[model samples]
Every structure is written in structure tokens, then in C-alpha cells.
Target: MTTMTFTRKDPPQWLLDFWKEIDDKTFGKGFDCFAHDAVCNLGVADWHGRDAIRENLRQFIDRGFTAHHDVVEYWDGGSLKVFHGKVRMTFDDPALPVVRPAMAHFFYMDEKDPAKVRRWLGSVGPIEF
Candidate 1:
């Protein structure tokens, strides 16, 4: 068996780019680039791996949900990068068409080559409207 060697590097720009990709896939309308085992949390649900994550997003898109993220804070400590943000999600559901105050915390590891996100954690709750 071969061991994969990962090096530490600046994470801010790279992580931002990754988030951009996710945005594109979710709202901007693009492809998904996360690894097979990537985990994601989207307010009402939790997903593990790329397929599940894709399905989760696909469900939102199928229901005509669009989202925009407002980044509040960002920190890059070499190998780890953290982003604190909120997302505004709008769907066609007439009764509950919008989801606001959606908070997210993205954790990135091995910034040198971010092919695999070691972990990603996110949550949504009521915030000052």
C-alpha cells in the first residue's frame, strides 16, 4: 500500500475557491468537485460522501432553491482554514419559501492540494433579522 503525503500551505484563497465551486454547483449552477467521502450539513439534513452530498443539493435544486452566502469571518492557519458565514436560501415553497439566518462553518485541511476536505461542519439557526 502506498501512503499519500500531504503538505501544509496557505488555505484562504484555496478554501475560498472551493466555496466558490460549491456556490456554483448550488446556486451559480455548475459541477460538484468534492471528494467521494466528503461530508456536508445543510440545516435540515446531514450527508456523508460525494453521492449523498450531491443528492442533497440536487434535491434543493430540483425544488428550485437558490442560495447566496454572506461570509462573515475567515481565518487561515496554514493547514486549517475556517469560514463563518450565513446563507440565504429561497425556494418555490409558498408556505416556507425562504430560509434565512443559515449559518455555516467550513473547515479545510491539507491546503496545499485540497482534493479532499478532511472535514466540513455547518449549522443553521435563528439570527437577528
Candidate 2:
């Protein structure tokens, strides 16, 4: 299997560490990245508050899929950060095909707590080049 290459462009150390937690399957540690009242919008559903978001993420992680994200680029706009990447998801079910989709994360940090994400909007799918 070919290794994924992360081409992150000077993203914050905290953000980098958060992604590490995701790839490492350490959701408990990664939960620190979100504020207590943070909101996550995944297009189809809106997960409000930290506990809800954490539960949503936990469900996804606990499912039979392992995900690896390869960050291709990053844009820092003060409190708003944008990350463009590709995720490779391998499912435990052999009948299911592996999925590699382009993903984008738009994170708005809490003004009072800069280290925490107040709002996160994410999209994943094939994009035209």
C-alpha cells in the first residue's frame, strides 16, 4: 500500500495535532479541539454542542471504517481556517470498495477561546480539477 503524503501549508500546531488524533483514532483527545458549545454542520446534518459533536464523531470512528486524511493545502484567515485534503477510507467489509474523496473543512475558532473551534462546516466528495 502506498503511503499518503500530507502537504499542509503552515497550519497551526494545534490543528496539526488534532488531525494526528483523528488519524491515530484518538477521538477522546481530539475532543479538546472543540468548544463546549461548538457546532458542526456536515451538510446533511447539524451536530450542535460539544457533547453532541463528540458523540457524532465517536459513532463515525467506532464504525467499521478506518480513515486517513492527506492535507493538500491550508488557508489561514485569522479566526477562520480552511483545510483542503483527501481522505482514504478503508472499510472492514471486503465487499465495500475503498473510498478516496476530496474533503474541505471550514473552521471558525471561538473568539473568546482561540484554541477551540466554535463552528465547523465540512464537505466531502469528488471535485472537478
Candidate 3:
């Protein structure tokens, strides 16, 4: 089993900038902002790498769905951080007309001296979505 620890510190400015970029890409740019090696679990699918993440985002975009996330809570360690928030997806599905809401957990690991998110783990539900 892998043990994880959480710490509270100020996140680097670049990380925050990355989040903003992701938001813009998903909502405004109609593209994906996650890295190629990003791991995503959103109760529907489990994806790894930037390619896989991008494909998943592409699928969403193809379906005319917009993914949005609000960071309700965050904990930052020097090399690691955890973010918790609500994720909502709004799509043009006539059957499912409302935004789907779920709890989101994001784990980020900083790589090298630049402190970029080398690895990201996200869980959205009991299943890998």
C-alpha cells in the first residue's frame, strides 16, 4: 500500500497559473490543459499521460460538454499538494440537461527544480471517471 501525507503551504505561482490555464483551455479555448501524463479518475474513466488526458478532454469537447472545476480547498507542501473541489460538467444532452456535479480530489507532485506537476492523480467517485 502507498501511504500519503498532506501538508499546508503556499503553492507556487506557476501551479496556480497552470490551473488558470486549464480553466481557460477547457472552458474558453475548447482544448485540454492537462499534461500528457496526467492521471484522471472521474467515475467514468481512468486515464494516464498527456495523450490519454487530452483524448479524454477531446471526447468531452466532442460531446459538447464543458468541464469546470472550483478549488474549494487546497493544501500545499513543498513538493506535493492536494486540492479538493466541486467539478461540474455541462453538456447539451437533451436527456441529461443539467450540469453533473461531483466531488473532485486532485493530487499533484512537483518534479525537478522547476516544481511542475510531474504526476497528477485525480479521483472523482468510487469508480475511475
Candidate 4:
């Protein structure tokens, strides 16, 4: 797995591990980071529950796309955590550009349980495709 570098504050270990699981294409492990009742907003659609979120994420992760996330900023405020990053996505299709600059924002809600995310509001912008 590639090491992630953050420009601002360092993120918690659990968050790092969660991202690692995603980068490693291990949805099962990554989905464990969210609560069973967690909600996820993927910009395109909103998914409720960890199971639904996992399925949505799995579809993208399995779409012949490999990504490397470079975290530019991170914030931790008790029950909330926010992270902004640029993801480098490479596609299997040679016809597509190898590098596309895409930015991602992740807002994690951890009110009741600090260990698990209760809600994840995420968005990826400037999608050229």
C-alpha cells in the first residue's frame, strides 16, 4: 500500500487504517469503520446503512479504477472529523487519461461513538468523465 501524506494536521490512526483498507481494495475491512446505521453521501447519491454504503463503494472500487489519495488537510473536532484530499485515479482503459486531478472531501460524524463513523458525507469533484 502507498503511504499517505497530509499537509496539515495528522489524522487519527483509525482514519488512516480506514483509508488504507479502501486503497487496498478491501471493502469488508473498510466498511467496518462505519456504524451499522451510518449514512453515506457520495455526491451522486445518498446511501443509508453500512451495508448500502459498502455496496456503493464496492461498485466503484471494482470498476477497474485504482486510486491513491493525497490528503491535503485534516481537522478533528470532538464529534466531527473533516479531511480534504486529491485522489489520483488510474483506469485500465488506455484510451482514458492516466492522471486526472480529482478532489475529495470527507466529513465524518462520530457523535455517539468516537470509534465508528455515524455518517459520512463525501464528494469528489471535477469529474471529467
Candidate 5:
């Protein structure tokens, strides 16, 4: 893992709830997490706005990927604020020798306030390089 240091800032209730919905396999219903014009750069692809974000996430789930966050760490500073976590992704594919994990990093900005995420630069990767 790369050495990183970020100020501790817990995610808001609404954001947490959105993740809960995702964990429950109900993603499209959580578009409220993203701002109206938020841009998301998912590792495999990039999307803009709530609709595109929903579509991207749906594709991810359909690829047999499910993420579970083990720990959430936050950081904030002058012009930098983010929350990251190390998570494991379970797959339904029998061909995979073992379940893989990934580091989920979110580079978020304050829209009108910290409660809303303005932009998202997210990355998800398989454990094996």
C-alpha cells in the first residue's frame, strides 16, 4: 500500500446511506450521493452526472463485483479533502481462483458544503497487479 496521510473526516449520513443501498444491490436509487453535475472517474471508465454514474455502477455490479469497506479514513486540508478505504470485492465467478480486493479512493470536493460531493475521482483495482 502507498503511504498516505489525510485529515480524519467521517462521511455524512446521506453518503453512508448511499453506500448501504449499494451494498444491498440497490444502486440506481442512491444517485442522491452525487451532485447534479458531478463527474466520476471510475477506474474502468468515467461518467458524468447522476444518470451516468448510475449506469456505470450498474455495469460494475453486473460484472460480478461487490465491494465491502473494512475501514474508512478521511482527510482534509487547504484544497484537498478525501475519504479512502481498503475493501474486498467478492465475485460470483467460479473461474476466479480466489476473491480479490481493491483500494477505493475518492477525491471529493465540497459543493455548497461538505454534505454534498461535487466531483468524484474513484479508482477500483484488483489486488493482483
Candidate 6:
């Protein structure tokens, strides 16, 4: 697993662990970080609730896609936490070539439950291989 470096303030341990799971190629373990009713918005698809999100994430992870997020900036304004970073992935499949996204941007807007990420909205722009 590659160690990811962040440019700003340190995120909570759980969040860090969550991301670490991905870098470790253990996306299933990563789902433990989300709330049961959380919502995840990928650029091309939106997965609602943890079950759907977990299953969808499993598909790519199972396919051997390694996900890494390198944070360039982060804003934790008490309730709203925003993330902007460079995301890179290794896609072992021939159909979806590996890509280096310009930056991974996301806004975790719901803070009703501090320990769990409730709502996530983000998109990554990729450079074609």
C-alpha cells in the first residue's frame, strides 16, 4: 500500500482509516466508515444508502481498481468538510483503462452525525490513458 500525503489539516482517525482501507485495496473494510443511510455521488452514478454504496464500490474494488486520494486542500468549517485532491487509480481491467484524475473534489455536507459521513457529493476528471 502507498502512503498518501495530505496538504492540510489532519482528518479524524476514522476518516483516515477509511481512506487507508482503499489504498490497502480493502474497499470492503472502507465501507465501515460510512453511515448506514449515507449517500455517495460518483460522477457517472449515484449510490444511495450504505448497502448500495458498498455493493457498487465492491464491484470496482473486486475488479482490482486501486483508489488513492492525495489531498491538496481541505476545509473543515465545523459542520461542512470539503475535500479537493488528486486521485489516481490502477485499473487492471482492459475495458476501463487506468486513469489519473485531475483532482478529486467532494463536499461532505451533512454533519448531523460527526462520526459518519452522511452525504457525499464529488467528481473526478480523468486523463485518458
Q: lDDT of candidate 5 vs native?
A: 0.64
lDDT of each: 0.58, 0.80, 0.55, 0.74, 0.64, 0.68
TM-score of every candidate: 0.58, 0.82, 0.59, 0.82, 0.73, 0.72
User: Roughly what TM-score does model 2 have, to 2 decimal places?
Assistant: 0.82
Instruction: Give lDDT for model 6.
Output: 0.68
Error of 4 at 43 (Å): 0.6
Scanning candidate 5 in windows of ten residues, the lowest lDDT window is 96-105
Comparing 3 and 4 by lDDT, which wins?
Answer: 4
Worst lDDT 10-window in candidate 1: 26-35
> Where is the poorest 10-residue window by lDDT in model 4?
2-11
RMSD of each: 6.8, 8.0, 4.7, 6.7, 4.6, 7.2
Clashing residue pair totals per candidate (backbone < 3 A): 0, 0, 9, 0, 1, 0
Q: Write the per-residue lDDT of candidate 1 for residues 1-129, one digit (tens) a residue.
A: 944444434434545565565556542222234555767766656788767766666665565656666777776554445566777776656666577674656555525456556556766666422
For model 5, how does the per-residue alpha-carbon lDDT over 46-112 read when each residue is reduced to its tens digit? 6878778877777777777576665467666423456566555666775664444545656575547
- What is the clash count of model 1? 0
- Can you write out model 3's per-residue Cα lDDT over 1-129, one digit (the tens) per residue? 966576765544554555554455543222233444556664557777656665565665566656566666678654567777666666667565545455545555535432445456666532422
Q: How many angstroms is residue 25 displaced in model 3 relative to the true structure, after the best TM-score fit?
A: 4.1
- In candidate 6, what are the lDDT values of residues 1-129, reduced to their tens digit? 844343456665666676676677665666666788888887777889878886776675676678776767676655456677776787778698767676554545456767677877777775335
Candidate 6 colliding pairs, count:
0
Candidate 3: list runs displaced more than 4 Å: 1-48, 125-129
Better of 2 and 6 by TM-score: 2
- Candidate 4 ranges with C-alpha deviation above 4 Å: 1-8
Which regions of candidate 6 fall more than 4 Å away from where they truly are? 1-8, 93-98, 109-111, 127-129
Q: Give the deviation of candidate 4 from the true structure as CA RMSD.
A: 6.7
**TM-score of predicted structure 5:** 0.73
CA displacement after TM-score superposition, residue 45 of candidate 1 (Å): 3.8
